[model samples]
Target: MTIIKFLTLTLGATAFLSAQSSPIRSCGKPLHPKTIVQNDAPSGTVSKENKIQVALLLDTSNSMDGLIDQAKSRLWNIVNTLTTLKYNGKAPQVEIALYEYGNDGLQDENFIRQVTPLTQDLDLVSEKLFALKTNGGSEYCGAVIRDASMNLNWDGNEKSMKLIYIAGNEPFDQGRINYKETISKAKSKNIYTNTIFCGDRSEGIQSFWQSGATIGDGKYFNIDSDKKVIYIETPYDVKISEYNSKLNDTYVYYGSRGSEYKNKQMVQDKNAEVQSASSSVERTVAKSRKNAYKNDHWDLVDRAEKDADFISKVKESELPADLKGKSKEEIKKAVAEKSAQRGQIQKEIEVLSKKRQGYIDTEMKKRGNPEADDLGKAIENSVLELAKKKGYSI
Candidate 1:
């Protein structure tokens, strides 16, 4: 071919490859982008610097349905607690990894499955957690812990808080992998391994659960997994829920499967609502915090905020139908409006959430605050203590 023709073909191929790799895609496309423009998936260093990494290893054996229920109800509460921590007076990035064990998964794999790798996508985390099922199988505490430690992209910063919480009723030393050695390896990497026994406290000690915590230099707690979680209703909850609805309206989604992911967000809201009024309210409050519930990967408003040139570079075909023919200036203006509106909604939710929390605290004090140790409380308490030790302020 002639030099000009060869150059034309090469440039055309380059453009095609760029479009395929770009997270920005045409609407109604089936290829859902995992990140933003230029594949904005958080790199380990960009996302994990001063990050709080939490890995939850829960046993999903047949008899542990109650434990799963508690986890579902309190996932938002745990997230809210983590959002309270501040490193250097700014919110630290939070990433959570989830794993299920003792579920009759695959025997060769030791009945373990890494549900989701550590991710900042809180909606995906909730989706995976709600989908978890239970079945009888071997509970290998050591193996799960080892898998989480080795597989997750944990933050290496000494100031970042790294934690592993394993909750189960089985003996801690039941796995082929040595619990003591695995926990020691985790500690060597500055990761604290917390053990939450689902049965009686003394039984947990007798079963070597306490030893696991001691070796890893973390907290040990035993909870009644079968007990129901009590939620306190406050007058502020209603107003907060109303604000949450408005907040949801401000998200502007683009790219492939954007609409599906948007629907998934609403479904998760319903899931929390189905759990209880308090859970729904807690989730709404968590969503108000940008540091806790980020959707920059798909939401145009968030992406615009993070990348100043995103609105300018986005192609007309990549935009939603309503925005397809709009000018770049018009699109930017629309995103700016949604962002401001969201900020107002979030502020309203935050004010009401604080009042709601205060009311709950007062009621608990009046009731003498019954000691009801459950999965969420176990993780929340331990996280607060450990975060403080890492010099993070609440």
Candidate 2:
């Protein structure tokens, strides 16, 4: 893409990103900010790189109609907002999945519906969300927790963090499965959950839902309004592969500190203050694909790869922050170089990762997860294997 185009997209995407900004630190401060109490990355405070898995658990109860209506209207805003993180990636790579409940919890058989599996494809999530019609019963937070932990593909890479978000109007308590077991399983595996309360807590179901969140080692927030619920967030690990080229400066700062945020407590909130930001979504016109949301990243993959040179240029430029009327040639050179290097690193990582995955695929064919195909158990061992390889203390 041309320089003019890139700048335009970055400017457009920032408004949306402000809402999902991590609460871990105020989007305040220079790249290196002073904290209330400096918690260093040493002592296993954070991970050098970030890998994230985000799941959305929805409430399909009869009363959630208006909430769902607003969801369709504003879903794209969230995606546009997240595009701001593209600076670090061959493209800003964020993978999100969705789940909805309330389809007959009163019956003894099925209560959960897997609208879309965990995916990088955002359109699948959007389609399912739009298709969602409220006509189910017995919304139970515990079921969603258990089902995701047991069935969803939760990536437990040592360099990454796995997050599950459960949103509903009903309390999570009262389910057939052991509620404590559901929460305990998630906590033990480092898969955190965030609960968005949809009903009136004062009416008394609040305590039950809160307790469920406590056991799951997750945070629960009450959403009284549409805007508040749609943007729910928690501190999540973002991979080196997702930052956009336009964000070269921001990427360099955060990439350096990624190791620190790795193990630290990542926090998220429904509302956040926006900081200086930009994303390329506005530059190029999104194509006329049937499932446009999922295809959002299609052409962008090339754009991300082109940034490999840019990544390296930025690393070397050591561009002094105070550009007092610098020449255009100098800035363009730095930008091009940084973009190329970022794309190159992403390419190399992809090669190594694919080679490694090929080895695992072969092994899995022979061993079948080193445990039963059980989701929770499979995730547990996956974490062990990844941590062992990464030289991290689990």
RMSD of each: 13.3, 19.1
**Backbone clash count for every predicted candidate, in the order shown:** 0, 57
Highest lDDT among the candidates is held by which one?
1
Off by over 4 Å in 2: 1-50, 80-92, 105-108, 203-205, 225-394
Total backbone collisions, model 2? 57
Across 196-306, the per-residue lDDT of candidate 1 in tens digits comes to 888889999999999999999988988888888878788888888887778889988887867777888899999989988888888898788776677877789878977
**Residue 80 CA error for candidate 1 (Å)?**
0.2
Candidate 2, residues 1-394, lDDT tens digits: the string is 0000111111111111111112121011222000111222221121224434556666767776655654443443333322322212212234555667765532334466666655544434544565677775777667666777766655555334455656566556656777678878877877765555654555324456667666665544454423322121212112212322222221222133332322121110101112011111111111111111222122222223335443333332333343224564565554456546544544443344334334534655565433312112212233233323333231
lDDT against the true structure, each candidate: 0.72, 0.40
